[model samples]
Target chain A: MSGGAERRLPGHYLKSKEMYSLPGLVEYRPVARYLFSAGQAQSRFLDGLKEGKILGKRCPRCGRVYVPPRSYCEYCMAPTSEWVELPGTGEVHTAVVSYISTFRERMEKPEIVAVIKLDAPGYTKGGYEFAGLFHKLCNVEPEDVISGRAIGMRVKPRWRPPEERKGDVNDIECFEPVES
Target chain B: MRPNIHVKNKVAVVGAGLTLFRRRMLETPRELAWEAASMALESAGLTLKDIDCIVIGTAPDAFDGVHLNGEYLADGAGGVNKPTVRVYVGGGTGVFVPIAAWWHVASGLCRTVLAVAEEKMSPAHPHPQGVFAYIWDPVLERPLGPNLIWIFALEMRRYMHKCGAKKEDIALVSVKNKANALDHPAAQAAAKITVEDVLNSEVLVWPVNRLDISPVSDGAAALVLASENEARRITDSPVWVEGVGFTLDNTHWYNRELGYPRYVQYAARMAYKMAGIERPWREIDVAEPYDPFDYKELHHIEGLMLARPCEAPKLLKEGHFNRDGDLPTSPSGGLLGVGNPIAAAGVMKVAELFWQLRYEAGARQVKKPVHRGVAQAWGDLMQAGTVIVLGN
Candidate 1:
């Protein structure tokens, strides 16, 4: 609506084809390589995953437990002092049906993802702070999530067979309802 | 937590400039910075020589596929031999640019500073959102394999659940902001869209239709900052930098309640205190809260104390956030309307506020007589909140 400047601002908007076809245009791709270090606490947690167990670090100063274990408690600014094995069971906090992958590629079967509030003694129910793990959910229909029937339902990890365990998050195939 | 109040000099913004926001641009990242910097200098009746120092902000270098992006953009930002510094807080980098420049003048170190922000998100292959593939934690979250939209959808769902906000209510923000963008010359995604259009648009993730988000854009924005004496010499009507605030919360975003942004509230509290405005809901005349997502605008409004928690939906439905409403927000169409180029988008919001405070914003100006305005941006895993309060 400003006079003399309508449809005028710096920079050029490239068309879809122009991006690939335009000569003198630079083209490159990310080589994609990463080697991440799993620190002392996380390495132990991974070791637990290899044994079909969930492990968490308890901050001695704050008594708050962190799943996927951080070496230090962010709140207390102190090194976590204790390791506790979890029952590998929790209730669904929130779930969404994912129709696309990391690259935005469509999937044949939509996957249900949920953040499970891992069972713990110290943390209050529905409190702001809690030890949780984000993972896939199974044995539930998309309708259960859409209808708000999946939340607050207790679920346990569906672990892969012992021989197939790789000391990774995928060791647990997915979390499924504990009840029938 | 209160910031140190004592400062040597008062700072003001003298000029601002922006480049067109588009999905893919022909110009290089440095070229975009030069264009915006040149325009800002030209508007202030000063050339690159007049700038004392430089403060540059850009998003993660991953998006542009270039390492050491700030140094690459230094010359274009008018930084050649002078001291040039780069600051980044993801999407919050734009507003943080001015905040960084404010310190230069406030510390009595640099009399005139050129603040610039630029982001070229198109160079990344597949989609810019793929950058998250690296940003995710390798051991914990990455194993789950999440698309970036999943986080936004999850938060939108949490907001809907906590505030009783329906998808219909949140869709209104996209409708309102895109409609407002139609008047903006630099707008990329501006359109007169309806809420139904948003509802029917492709749902990339649940509750997050394509229209519910700002487009991936390539653009740059710049601002000229000066000490009070330098500002008075440049222009009679200068927008003083009344206050600047920024804060970062713990990275454990999932541990906290997703409904409200406590980090932004803490940042806004700091900014409002510095400006001596107790009641932001009433004192702030016009606002441009971050709106990368429709619900985020409402989320930040409450965090900024412009509305009580869960009250933004009711206020939005009443047209209270419209351009002509009593407490108009995102009149520059915000990130939703303007286009989200990461860092540049935040600077665009501040640029719009600069124009609004000076009565220079032509038709995009709010109807109310405005004396004070605020612009904010949030980024860095939904943790960093940067705010600036400007007044004539």
Candidate 2:
């Protein structure tokens, strides 16, 4: 049975309010580590990241190249053998402005999160899906994000310094819009 | 056409029970499960000893602050030293609990299966919001310092922008569901509120608001499932478990159109096909689409094919989703009004449908007679959908 809204304690209401407020709990635990399998194909993909280059695996059955390097093709379920380098330019599909931190507390400065649709050739089966990744949008105003102009805008990865490259997912900094 | 499924025996839900949906309960997680499970077994005219096997569903163990929580709750759920299986699919675990039991009885694996679902969000130190951090990408997404509401708000905004639904329009769902919860004995947020109340509530992230969301709750719900032979001998009006379905989409939630829930549609299709239901909007007499957030009810109603995409909000405004309306959605109130104990909240929705189909819901009964009913739940990065169909 649903709890009566009128009988709801103030704590209930307050918790709901906490989601958007600033200074929220930002540091979360426990630490999580994910292991990536660097098989013959992903090893080269990892090597490319260390050298500040984006690499993908190509499937022979469907002739598709997958970014982030997959050992097998999702669509054809065939083994991939070729490693392909990409231009790393794509368009933003959606974006949002976050005033609260990851812990549901408020933040002094709001951050903009955007989903970039990568320009991988034959990445998705019919373009309904894509080789897109979620990341922060640099050099974009919150108003631009809210106005829907941030979407469909061309963007390129802003990589970190060459010496600072760690062969990790965060090696490339936020993605920035490519000006005409 | 021959059915694509095999049913060794008929399965019926004999009893159901739930704990008070509270923002925070003093009782421990195991205690909450025991309280709800005891009540369900007592209602079924049985005891823990009569249960041949047990099936339990709890959302993420993170909320309870204990990993492998199913094992931790086994004794309290009355599964000690008995064959037990814990199933999880985000919030869908509530109905999935019974579905797990359905297979046990339907496949001749057990005669009586006790299904329990529980969630205690209060145990998480500091604030439960910290638990949501793990749901995002640790390498890429988390470094952006994103709040959990961002994803939900993004989807809600996209749904509203695409469906031509106004915030005020979706507020009616909050109003109706909350009002319906007023009659619920364990309701946490049941109230007679107006759309203005929802509109005036603090906006957390543009589209999402304080009132539009369900409270983090501590509670538990349980159900008893039995084979046809055991069901007929136990009760005259056993609610039959007709069909069940679950599906998951890729983790790339934003890659696809946010207007429609393809995962929910796929799950609903699988259930309807098994139940021999050709037209859900016309065939199903009643429904409960998961409503963790007010707009989620409308989103899931479309996902369940109860209404076409972009139609739920309008239909809601037209009184088509009220308790006395043509097709009552969430007649037992919903997560918005009921209080969301995560996994337990979903199970409560399933139990409400069981009560409605059995003609046992006294004050909270829908206006019309119900021969068949459906309950659907969505969870996990907006990617998982679970559907269950029940009939008399």
- Chain B TM-score against the true chain B, each candidate: 0.98, 0.98
- The window of 10 residues in a row where model 2 chain B has the poorest summed lDDT is B137-146
- TM-scores of the models, in the order given: 0.96, 0.88
Task: Write down the TM-score for model 2.
Answer: 0.88
- Per-residue lDDT of B81-198 in model 1, one digit per residue for the tens? 9999999998889899999999999999999999999999999876877787777778877888888888777777678777889888999999999988887888888988888999
lDDT of 2 by residue, B1-392 (tens): 22768889889998887878887676678888998898788778999888999988899889987889999999989999999889998877777788788889999999999999999887676678888877875544565666788887777766776687887888888888898888887788999998888989876676677888888888999999999999998888889888888998866575566767889999999889989888899988899999988888999999999899898988988889888888999998899888888888888898888888877777778899899999988888878998999999
Share of the reference A-B contacts seen in candidate 1:
0.59
The lDDT of each candidate is: 0.88, 0.81
TM-score of 1: 0.96
Worst 10 residues of 1 chain B by lDDT: B250-259
